[model samples]
Target: MQSIEKYPHYFNSIKEVHENIQSIIPEIAGAYKNKYNLSFPVDINLIVGGFGSNAYTYRQIIPNITFALEKLSPNPDHLRVIVAHEFGHLAQYIMLDDAGMDWSKSRWTHPLIWLYREGIATHLSRQIADNIHPSVYFSYNDEGVQWLTFAQANMIRIKQAFMEDFKALTSEKLFHEWFSINGGNRFGYSRLAYFLGNRFVLEYMEKHGEQATIIAWREENFEAKIAQWLSQEGVDKSE
Candidate 1:
């Protein structure tokens, strides 16, 4: 795997943050490979910008993993969580490819599908970081901890709220409602899907085991399996 670093002037001004990322790259990559079983070479790029701290994987001639280092906590542990989460996406893509599935064909517009993808990544991130230490896994940042706490505390309510709207909504409508800032906030929580998805993954892992969960995710009938699991748990999706 190859790595590239690009720091904005402001980012370069912070010696610790820059140095922390440099120090953490190998650890992140090592954890990713050992945990996720991903062996393909990926181009990992770190960029400093104001667009918000997020990571994306671009599959072109090679898999390009890019992380935007804006609005991120300077804490190295926090950065590790972000890196692990992003690497989860890369792992997902590789798994899909191995399963003879095209990542481009993923139904991003579907809220459930989007939730599963993000949730799995979040779950993997937590697992990867926890392998180092429990504190690093759980207390990466205040907002993340708060959001996760809120999500867990209100999981049933969130599921009920989602079920109430899932039937009548189209994929596009569902995506907008569940993922968009204004739409997400309408249900008294924003980005609820991330938490919900994480819960879903956790449930699956609890029942099926981690490697099985990953395999299930790669299968074409993954959503159907999720729906069945939800039904078994009495999560009503019918109108």
Candidate 2:
């Protein structure tokens, strides 16, 4: 574990946020494990930016660790939800490589990674709340909703592409270029992927059973995986 100095004397509120986050970790992890059958005491990947900024990350590294995390919240209830959303990231990251596309430096690399990453993380942040809890959001930005909607529309298409009808994107340069060109829309791409990916996963489980979905999530043919998604949805490729 590494320790970074706190943002010295910024908004001072950052410390409170930090303390709040640490306090809630254990309870959050417990809920995730119980609900999802995930491993407990999960690793946390937290990045707190100077006033008015935050980012979350998780790795697809092996040995399967899903740190069920809720995000930063001053309120106790919101904090727990944030932690769970982060846990969602951990779950997605563990399954990333199995989807078979390498991570691209491009902002656009998100789609290649797997449908779970972008949408779920944001979904956790924005949606995924108990009836009593406050919703998470991207700085109360309406554009955020638009981006999410965009992703939701295209998700089915992207997942199908992941399963099939896809080219192995090996060019790092191309990846970076496309990502840079797309910029924030890359986020939208991720959202779209998640929207579709989770549905596919849900249906897959219903049809194949939990164990099969977990195993096939790791080994199914990329094209075959996509066929089901693409058949049902037409992506709004505008942008």
Candidate 3:
């Protein structure tokens, strides 16, 4: 429920981001409460540096939500989407806790599970964005447009290559290769899992309703459902 901003020395002059985060926090909190029935009072820290475009959520010892402002797009709408996305992770943490699921145990090590996590968060974020401003759901200027476009264009080839190689790889190796920018076989894009995860979520939402999708996050059989859905949808095969 508390929003904190930690600016790097280089970002001392930035003042607008504070106002921006302040404006979006209530909206995100409201959406989480309405959609997931969870009151998220977690401390959200916006910092200056991180790895990817999305805000990072740490759930190990404590629930920490950190957003790397430098990594996010400067567009205000885009920033709102990022906040919703990270808050979706916060919602997941609460749901997982209530369900008695220990994410750090062994499930965190699985790449596909990570894909589902990211995908579900992406879906919820889009839902929140749509509720706030429908236009921003998939804005042309959004970075996700480029990633989704590239993924769709190359899905056939990417899926083909993935199935061929996936059988021979370990979970850790597969996770890194699919997610790393320097892996050198990403079909000219990194974070292939994000795109795949998004598609998986879309398929699930289309078949089931949004409520079902939201409830699946806390289900013990969520991973099994993901595997079954992938097989049923033939994710590894050409359409």
Candidate 4:
């Protein structure tokens, strides 16, 4: 009701987003299934007027995915990238579950865990939905040039700032600063940690190979390793 009242002008655009999602999700799901060589059925739910999340994975009871149409763009490329991104999450969960990962032991509350999860999902989205403009993977819109450029130019400073927060032991504010849409006080860009996470995943893949990087959180020192990456102590700063 509030969303309907707040932005009545966007209702038509939201409807178009719904239509685009319906048309494209099957193809996106098929691509991910083939790329990962997995046969699980994809369950997608369309929604509106929620908490402004573009899309999210619901892992309780069953592996279900939902997209908030009002929070998404009507562009087909955006739909493909976001849909594949959610499914990327599903793939990560299923792979770990099938491998007998102990859910009770997982560090579900840590910032590092969040970083790795989003990073791997973002990375997988680009791979499944290949050869589009790079900004789509991060921004979900064609107008994300500024966001990407800012993040790329300030990699060292961002990583160092994150490293400081990681060592502070105050995770609630840290998580919001890095991951939430409402945060930008640090660098004036929300979800900058998503970019940082993707960079960590890319480097980890280069060093440790694919499967290991996907399940890197399983190791006990996962957060420590992520902190080390954020420290960037001796690493090259000019990229």
- RMSD score of candidate 3 (Å): 5.9
Q: Model 4, poorest ten-residue lDDT window? A: 230-239
lDDT of 1 by residue, 1-239 (tens): 11224345346534565678777777877887786667658777777554543556674423678766654556777878877877776677677677666656555445567778777778778877764433333334545555555666666777776766677778767766775544565456566766667778877788888766664655666677655544444442210
Where model 4 places Cα greater than 4 Å from the true spot, the runs are 59-62, 234-239
> How does candidate 1 fare on TM-score?
0.75
Expressed as tens digits, the lDDT of each residue in 1-239 for candidate 4 is 77657667788898899888887888977886788875557567888755477888764423788888888989898888988888888888777776767777788777888898899999889988888888889888897788888888788888888877778747888888888888878888888889888989989899998788887777776888887788764443222
Candidate 3: lDDT of 1? 12
Name the TM-score of candidate 3: 0.73
Model 4 lDDT at residue 177: 85
The clash count of every prediction, one per candidate, is 0, 17, 2, 0
Per-candidate Cα RMSD to the true structure, in Å, reads 6.4, 8.0, 5.9, 2.2
TM-score, ranked from best to worst: 4, 1, 3, 2
Error of 1 at 118 (Å): 1.4
The lDDT, on a scale of 0 to 1, for candidate 4 is 0.81
Give candidate 3's whole-model lDDT: 0.62
lDDT scores of the candidates, listed in order: 0.64, 0.44, 0.62, 0.81
lDDT of 2: 0.44
User: Candidate 2: where is the Cα deviation over 4 Å?
Assistant: 1-13, 45-78, 89-113, 116-182, 185-191, 209-211, 234-239
- Candidates in order, TM-scores: namely 0.75, 0.52, 0.73, 0.91
